[model samples]
Target: MHAITKTKPVPFLDLSAQYKSLEAEWLAAIRETGARGSFILGPNTQALEKEFAEYVGVKHAIAVANGTDSLFLSLRALGVGKGDEVVTTPFTFFASAETIDMAGATPVFADILPGSLCLDPASVRARITAKTKAIVTVHIFGYPTEMGEIMEIAKKHKLAVVEDCAQSFGALHNGKVVGSIGDTGSFSFYPTKVLGCYGDGGMVTTHSDAVDERIRRLRNHGAVKPFVHTEIGMNSRLDEVQAAVLRIKLRHIKDDIAGRQKVAQEYTQRLAGSPVKTPSLPKNGTHVFNLYTIRVPKRDAVRQALTDAQIGTSQCYPQGLHLQEVYKHLGYKPGSLPACEHATTETLSLPIYPGMPLDHIERVCEVLLEAVRG
Candidate 1:
């Protein structure tokens, strides 16, 4: 294969470059944490929680171990449990549904809107039953779902609305941030997210004091006092080191999100009139540009061609959750949810992070267009 060499290289994520940019500041924060000798549930963790709560426009924000735990804790705080059904989209990351299970509830699958790739509110209405206790609408790929209608539907049904903001930390819906609109919102700080820490981190945001109390107590083993347990809870507290790193990055989040928005605009401009279908923005929401995904007819073939050309591409979800073997007992056959199935087969995620330059994105787009034409 010495005869075949790539003209360009593209990676799905360049975490190393991002880290390098903040190496000096990150190392200083880490050394300071070590010097302080307070690694868990300390000053940095508390400060991060306060700052994050204010940023999300919520009354309280509780730091958790990771995104899945954030969802599980939110469901638990809302008093969802065994035999209860939580309506959610089957077209998102598995963590959205997995957390429902972790909260001891059954996950009810719903179809997502075709254009926006978020929960279809009308479909959600049809899925509601007496057993339905809550709705977990995932803001997939950092694009906010239409929340105004979804919130109205939830209110009519007397169901709690949990915004799965794991992919949308800074996204907005109708001039308001996503995490602040729902009954509660969950976020993930995985290394690849728009606003991420050096290690795993998560947050739960809410306006209700009662719900906040539940999450606070639950993350700390259900104890109101030290060594005294009231209810059963799990160990899901954020570490001080991750909180420190997140605090440093949080100050620059607006700038980071602005950079991403600029890149997304460039992609939209360049990809216009192409055969591949580009993602559309919702009427009432601001997309944070977590992943710039598009739908194409020959998705698999184009993906392979990109890989051959040293251009990285990702398939967000190859199979819908309802069609997965784990949920076979739900009795959802292949054709039952046609929209979700179709999306799974055709959707492809492209790299669109803040660290890359405009010329790099243009090069990626050219490679992508060429691959599709072949």
Candidate 2:
């Protein structure tokens, strides 16, 4: 075994470093957003909606309170409800499946592709049945899902398709932006995401004007007027302040994605042929490197070693949603959906954000090697 190693203090995420680069501009924008006093459904929100819609190459973008709400509204807009089933990958953030349940539908688990770690279309096809009304395919870890195959299956089954692009804004599949490829594309601006705002915010992208109109109403208490309610809807609107912050961040998103790509490349070059299964990029998809994840044996020990070495690491979905007690009623066992289940035990995400330096990447690789040597 290699000798245990040490590293200088490393943070899992350095949001402050990114903020410092844009501090002056962001502060000014925040003050401006506040002064307008048009806190909700204001000019900033409308502007962001237009810009983001264009960025994703879609006709409409509906701003919502958060990512989960974006997915919920998408399901509602697609007419997904009780006695319906939405086919989804088990190897993703729970919100993908949870939104289906929130929309009064069941979430059917599907396996993921071995290479891209996105939903496998064959698995999706196998799971489809009469109850299946839609497919919610997640772009896991910023890698675009196989949209072509999934879309064909959805078309064959007459099902709606929702692209869970929360981790994959700006990513592309077959030259088309991920959000534009589905009936609705959902994005999150949580503080940690690549294109994050100052606080919680999310948006849904769609080409259908009809779906856009429904989402617009659903986000604001299902009302066309101030007091009249057309249908029961939840409160989920992106306020002006958050929208303004998003607008500022959006301008630099391409540059941010480039920087993250650099870090990911460095990690891959440094860790090549090591005892870890490095993240893979598909030939047909563009990767945004939201979180550079790897699968390794003895994940816990490596995590502890990295912690001891002052290098930060974390587990992404350490337990797959199906294995959780919350959904034990689904009757999934250890062998069910083996790909996602195996990933839950072996995956670990390393720090690879825009602001990390090459030295940090090198030290991280060195420390990881030492930890796994044991």
Candidate 3:
């Protein structure tokens, strides 16, 4: 009789472990804010904006209610509205394109690079037309896009550039931080993001003082002064509680990113020579490893095997934006963007986070290998 061996289940993202690690600091900050009676856009939020701006090497940072609003407000502040077209990659979260539509602009789809899954600069150039007013570039899975080329393209066309930093809190491109390179950058603090708050929170970074002042007013119902509305705007202020929580987490972000990098290296080393194509890091950029995604055959089957073994996994996006029913009216056929469609079919995100155990990585690789071989 062989002895039974038990395997510990690995979660895709262990938010509880993360919370436990900083419970004391987070609790203290929350308690202090509650005692101060400053709930909405107060000292904590203001301080967070200042610290975040410094971190991103930007002149200003505006804290908003969520990531979507960050993008919407950035577009609106740039005067992108009806009859305008925003160019962006189709292989990303819907918000990247949805916000363009929310701003009353049409989203023009561009393909992505097969390796990095970031927008292809050539594809972006091909999409530009007379109506194109902006480009919303997303750092998918924390991999920075080729900003040098994209920036040149934007400059040639005189288009506004909005960097969607939702999945890339600390990623860098060509020795420059992502948020600082573009005209405006939007960051999300959803619980699963690289640097997240307890609840929904977001920030916008920019170097232009004019854009900064406009976004500040746009976030607060276009109020240049208290109760004085200049233009129609929605309410999207970051709460002091979430701001305090983010401030504490920001203190440990570097260490957290290091831990995630370690885990990613382990996965790459272990999965070497396997059919699975591991993430490729750019020599001139830094990847924060928000989601350690890989390309593999039989992706769905492998994902199912991992799930059956009680090891969690995810598909960051099962469908590209052009293929979504909402965009069917855009008249894009199935193969309009081959790279983006291929990515949707092949990519799978394995369990990964800061401080993940080596044993868990080994188990996931073992299960994935067996499934792939079979």
Q: In candidate 2, which residue pairs clash?
A: none
TM-score, per-candidate, Cα-based: 0.97, 0.97, 0.98
RMSD vs true structure, all candidates: 2.7, 2.2, 1.9
State the lDDT of candidate 3 residue by residue for 151-199, as single tens digits: 9999999999999999999999988888999999999999999999878
lDDT tens per residue, model 2, 1-374: 23333446878988888888888987887788777767898999999999999999999999999999999999999999999999998888889989999999999998887778888888889999999999999999999998889999999999999999999999989999889999999999998897898889999999999999999998988997799889998899999988887888899999999999999998898788889889999798789989999888999889998888888887997887778787899898888888888888889999978968777788888889878876
lDDT of 1 by residue, 41-111 (tens): 89999999999998989999999999889999999999999999999999998999998998889999989
Pairwise lDDT winner, candidates 1 and 3: 3
In candidate 3, stretches whose alpha carbon ends up further than 4 angstroms from where it belongs are 1-7
By lDDT, who's the top model here?
3
Candidate 3, position 192, lDDT? 92
Candidate 2 overall Cα lDDT vs. reference? 0.90
Q: Single out the weakest 10-residue window by summed lDDT for candidate 2.
A: 1-10
